[model samples]
Target: MQKVRVLIVDDSALVRKVLTTMLESDPGIEVVGTAADPLIARDKIKLLNPDVLTLDVEMPRMDGLTFLDNLMRLRPMPVVMVSTLTERGADVTLRALELGAVDFFTKPPADLANTFMDHAPEICAKVRLAAGAKPRERAAVSKLDVAPRLSADAVLPLAQTPGTRGGTRIIAIGASTGGTEAIRVVLEAMPPTAPPIVITQHIPAAFSGPFAARMDSCSAMRVMEARDGQPIQAGHAYIAPGSQHLLVMWDGAKHVCRLHDGPPVNRHKPAVDVLFRSMVASVGAATIGVLLTGMGDDGARGLGELKEIGAPTLVQDEASSVVWGMPGAAWKAGAANEMLPLDAIAARLLALAHTPVSAAASRVGT
Candidate 1:
């Protein structure tokens, strides 16, 4: 097979050198060229014709976002962003993904020389995966804005009166690629008293905090990065921190979140499969599993397990997905009880959560 050709674009000479060395160390990847900034990277891209480009968020002459916008508009190609591991970096990285970046990595602290050393393998793998990616048409800039837009068809009718106690319901949601915005839409639409939600999105470690904070600010639910031993609560959402696998553990009395630094499963540290599998074991028939828009089949089998255990599973239909890989897997595997468009998912979840216990049980039994 032909080696995956990669071009490194960064303002820092050291970063360019380190990335080139790290990526080239893998037999499957070849360093085609290195550029000091996006301007130089543009020239190199034309000349070298690399399969993938690793871009830095900040640059001297042009910021990564501006460069990315031009690249996607003029000459669409697969690009991965390398961003600093800070709140600002996380925000920019999320925007970069929305702007058409295939993936992103958070650069370790300047003092931690061993950090890149450890992440080299993962970085190389992402470069390989990115090389074969097909770039999506750029969304209108207005559509890319983070602000929420309410759709009449997507709205759930307000409950007339408070219903009596029903059995506890747990929700496990998994997403990637276009997940940031997709999740924002769903969470913002949910009621403040919605059931407990556990989520796993493909994000770097430094990004999770800011991502959770962003969600917290926009949604009624209290969202935070999951901490080991934290008790799950209604109207609260827990996001798995980067580099750790989050699993739900039920002690017959209460459900708790556990964070573990385990090997990457299905090419993701906080893999959707790991969380879905644990939720299947912990919540059984009482859970509602959602497979949202993302790239890859990480959550398919685990969602199948959830369905087999009588959990109501929903998948984002391809028309609404940015990548359609994860949800497509679930739909193809027949794991999804319903395949709905993104705009319809929130309303459906609300309807399902409000279903009477007896009706819910009877529906599950069928």
Candidate 2:
């Protein structure tokens, strides 16, 4: 197989060198060139024609976002952002994703040469995934071996009982890689009074609050970071904090959000499986499980469990996904009862939110 060609763009010489070393460490990747700024990067992009571009979120001469906007509008291709783990960095990185970048790698504030190497595998894997992706399409797979991946059972066991027929219907969503933008699209299309929705997206702690804030600004529904013990309510969407696993639990009167700081499940603290399985226990059949675009199979099993207990499950189709890894896995596992494009998912979810659990159960897999 041909190696993935990459172009590194960063204003800092140290960053460019480090990124070059990291990319070259992977046999599957080849760094074709490096650029000191977006202006230089533009020339390199045309000259090198690299399969993928690893761009600094902040660059000299021209800001990264402006270049990204121009690139996507004119000559679209897969781009991954290298971002600092700062408030401004988070905001800019999120905008980069919106502007069509496939994914991002966050740089820690303190360390560069030492700490950054620890994440070498992650960044290289992201580049490989980005190489095959369409512009604005999220990358689909990650092969980082930083830790032994655990299941939702590590945080909370699969609930064996049937879901209680509910007073309030709940919607649970999980995504990674391309999830931030996909979630934005889904939430923006939701009506003001949609069912209570919970989300888990793979992100850094510094970015979660800003992500929630960004979602709230555009979504008709009230969107916020999930707080431990917060009551789940209609017309509101709760996003899992990047540092915690968000679970929905019954509190005798109503359902509430529960945050867990257990070891990362499937190598993600905010594992989609944990949230999906928690809904299996908390709402059972009253839950509507949806798996959007992501890079792994974290939520596939839990979604299957929801289907077993009579919840309606939907997955975003590949044509509309930035990455089809998660939804494709779930579909193969028989977890999803319906597969729809991104544009149609919100409306279908709105319609399914009102479907009786008994009817939903009967219709699934038919």
Candidate 3:
């Protein structure tokens, strides 16, 4: 593989030096240049044309968000934001992702100055994954601002109500990499009347709550980060808190969300496999499994398990995925029954949830 050339952009001279040293430590990465601001970064972008850019949110003359907006519209390259781990910082980072950033990492803990080396592996990993991402113009996603929001009744007007007694069906979804926007696209098109949906997207804890809020603002379904012990309800979607694992368990007759502070599975705290495997015990047979765009094979085995006992499984096709590693892994493992684009996933899920089932009905007719 060729070396991944990187350009470091931050107003702080110290941060730029630290980041360049950290990124270049790996033999696969080459620090092409560094810039103190987006203005200088603009010139470097044209000159060095680095494979990846690490941008800081706060800057002089031009802020990171505005610069990112301009970059995606004109050049549309892969970007990763380096931000502070604060509420205000999370807000801007989410906006950066909306503008087309591939991923992010927080400033290393002040107490870890001696051990700040912990951040290097993750930073390099994100940059490597980003180098291969399929970034689109922001104009397409900006149109989502005007998409008509359908009420619960508008989603599946002809289907029977989803949540009732012990019969509440669950829709389980998992994604990573470019999932923030992918999840938003699917949820925005869904009606509130759709079955209860649980999501596990790979996101930082500081950003998860804001990501949910942003999802809710654009989506018809009420979206919120999952709280431990919250009862699963129709017309709402629960995102796994980034710091913990979100699992499902039968709270009497109703399936409810359970957050765990367990060790990381598949190298992720709120891993897709953890949530997908949990669904097998809590909502067996009455589940619709969706594995979306992501890198790595975190969800593959768990999704295969879901397929074993008869649940319909869907994957976002490679043409629409940012990485296709997760969905492609699951498909190769015989986990996916349908491979659809991002736009079609919501409708297919609704169809499976609404179709009447008999004792003999095993597979979804569609």
Q: lDDT for each of the candidates? A: 0.80, 0.89, 0.81
Weakest 10 consecutive residues of candidate 1 by summed lDDT: 140-149
Q: What's the candidate order when arranged by decreasing TM-score?
A: 2, 3, 1
Question: Candidate 2 regions off by >4 Å?
Answer: 137-145
Tens-digit lDDT string for candidate 1 (112-197): 35467567766776787677656654650111112232211121122232222225787899998778878988898888899999
What is the per-residue lDDT of model 3 for residues 130-158, given as tens digits with 9 covering 90 to 100? 88888767820111112232221221122
Models 1 onward score TM values of 0.77, 0.96, 0.89
Find the number of clashing residue pairs for candidate 1. Answer: 0
Q: Candidate 2 on 199-296: residue-level lDDT in tens?
A: 99999999999999999999999999999999999999999998899999998888999999999998788999999998888898888999998887
Candidate 3 error regions (>4 Å): 111-113, 139-165, 357-361, 364-366
Candidate structures ordered by lDDT, highest first: 2, 3, 1
Poorest lDDT segment (10 consecutive residues) of candidate 3: 140-149
User: How does model 1 score by TM-score?
Assistant: 0.77
